[model samples]
Target: MEFKDYYKILAIDEKANASVIKASYRKLARKYHPDVSKEENAEAQFKEVGEAYAVLKDPEKRAEYDLLRAQGTYRSAGGSYQPPPDWQSSHAGNRTHSQRTDENFSDFFDSIFGAHGSDFRQAEDFQRSTNRRGRDLHYKIALFLEEAFVGCQRQIALRVSEPDQNGSIKQRDKTLNVKIPAGVTEGQHIRLTGQGELGIGGGKAGDLLLEIEFAPHPYFTVDGMNILLTLPVTCWEAALGSTVEVPTLRGKVKLKIPQAANSGNKLRIKGKGLISKGGEISGDQIVTLQVSLPKERSSEAKALYRQLAECESHFNPRQAFER
Candidate 1:
């Protein structure tokens, strides 16, 4: 068997960290995924990459491979390469890391870590079993506040693991068109049946769990199911009621400001927020009033303020201070 340089196959430094190894595997896996990749021999290259990751991702396997490389055991010029003479007598054969069968790997890999003796038959039999369910996958999706309020449909592509007739796992691309229901809050999970990793043998496939997250909005804040907004108004509007246009998830609506309304006061706009998942209850929009004053007052405005202060002179706005 030809010696396989797992590090070179993964295109990483010999001393690459665990995170770097994992990241490189994902990038290369996507690049050569059979369903999406257009490169020549894409399927073969994809398999090689997966094999490299399986060895490098495991610390024990990587250490053993490194030792072989360090001793120049595999650097021989012969067309075939083999492990040290004592490899079978050592712990390499019984080293249990991956659950995959020796056939999933090349003869070079089998030479180092393959099963031996009476246990070999049991291992082969176990690998052929088809009663194990596939693995479930989790993915996070971000939605705009508007989309969450009214619901939307999205199409997403993902790389999933599948087993061939030989029970060897392969990477493949799967696309799903998903409907995001209205009122999906942050951290909510939407499960799609049998959309995850393919099961071994004839076992059932796993489900895909999509975690929901909300993108930040420039004009609104969320409080549970309620939508919160700070509506700015002139000081005069607060003292002597006025009608103003307020933005809601549905659209803009005219809101009535009660007479003598003060800053920090909250007004509830019923049934204007998010809807319940079952469509039974609707949250109200909470509008908080913030009174604003003119930054630059004209001479006429100053005179009007003086007259108003005089008219309300007995109101000593801070009379409680004297007590």
Candidate 2:
């Protein structure tokens, strides 16, 4: 539980607004997105950026975090300090000041902020008589393609901090049930009120913002509501045209392929894609046809090919390429 200075990560003051935080995060994330970055420790730096944005992007969490910092309890790990008794008990059962997992933070943070119990307790005392709004918390949720299409419920586990009589910090785990609505898109946000950081002075509790992301599927790629799939068809199937069974987010459906259909031909399934939130509109699933050739050929097959090649000598497929 080392102390994390999010302000330093974003190169901004504690007074920076949501826009500033988002701008800084985007700039940094692009520089360290792993796919394009060659810098050493880029991934670590990226994680830190995300963590900072998670707290600073929301007003409630920012306020609560600032409040804790105002108290002597919040300090860098390098600083030497100890907590007094009754600090943890005061902030018990408050979720806004929840402790991040030790795995997510650096060892330096653990050595410094590991004892969050006292900090939270001090925060409680500071707000004992004040009117404060609850803090907003951020959560990242992974969804399957089917879940994203049809909607689903999920159980999420979170770790938080609790205090002891001696003002020592201890880690605790809590589980929550979350309902994911159908047709949820990646990067879309779902808000759950009163599930965020606790408000000070008996004020209203904050909200929890869950950001949606879909797990990679072997067969499909999703872009907004559109579903893209590359379906492999046999040569005969493409040449003769046939009804093929295709898989969608919902289930399998038959697709009619017209005769003489070429490779790379696209077929659309209307209203069979993702559903839009709070709207009756649905996206279309685009299926691209790919022709696969047999790798092995028997002697009879080769003789038949030779006969066909002799009969089709008038057709030169590469005349355009030669020209």
Candidate 3:
């Protein structure tokens, strides 16, 4: 079986933290998700991405993969390689060794970690209740950060198996309207009780667990509850400071830029980012000051800039560089 560099597949540094790994996964998952992706071989890419994340997301699996990678020679681009025999035995011994009956995974995965990966367990946990309950179904819900803060309802459709006439299972499309609560962040799971598969005779149905993911927003980048926004300012605005109106999901809020605010300077606005239910915690909006020049420099503007340059000759911005 081919050796797969899980970290390389996810396009992350080997030293990346869990949050970084998750962010990369979410971005790639959205781009290559078979249901929405426009790229060729999206289905295959999605599975590869999923498989890679399945290993690295778990601490134990990641450690074992790292051990195998160090012991054997494997390239990031992924050439032919196999795990040393007893690779699993040598490392963590308490993990499940069962291969998934589902044929959706790769042979490379089966050769080492097998179907006991997190993806399958996340979708259908093997340790389900033995009380004749229906199997729990897993689903993913994508939302913009704005929608997450305000809460919204979504209608999703999925095909599920149900018992038909003569006690045989048949595929049927199921539509569900899920209510997402406010302040929901990425990776949060919401369970809808008894919304999963049809139970057997006189048995209760299982629950549907909706995994939350925030879609990439155009201007805002989320770090936990905090939201980052790059706010553009005129050169004078940075040098002389000015009051500017910034935008949030709620609406426009005025920001006070202090004098001498340099490009890349971050200004904090408390309680303006995102708020949790009952207002327990609020994420501040980090407005990064970005100084911008006019797109087209007119003759007057050019002359004024030259005049300013001459006037500021004594003020060398790079004075600190001189030893």
Question: Which of the numbered candidates is closest to the native, going by highest TM-score?
Answer: 3
TM-score of each: 0.57, 0.56, 0.58
Backbone clash count for every predicted candidate, in the order shown: 0, 10, 0
lDDT tens digits by residue: candidate 1, 162-279: 7653334689999999999988887889999999887653457899999998888988988888999999999899999999999999999999999999899999999998887887
For candidate 2, the per-residue lDDT at 71 reads 78
All candidates' lDDT scores? 0.79, 0.69, 0.76
Checking candidate 3 for backbone clashes, the offending pairs are none
Off by over 4 Å in 2: 1-130, 161-171
User: Across residues 108-167, which tens digit of lDDT does each residue of candidate 2 receive?
Assistant: 333433524444344334323333455687889999889987789999876644332222
- Range of the 10 consecutive residues with the lowest summed lDDT in candidate 3: 123-132
Residue 73, candidate 2: alpha-carbon lDDT: 69
Task: Please list the residue runs of candidate 1 whose C-alpha ends up more than 4 Å from where it truly belongs after superposition.
Answer: 1-130, 163-174, 316-322
Looking at candidate 2, what is the lDDT of residue 88? 38
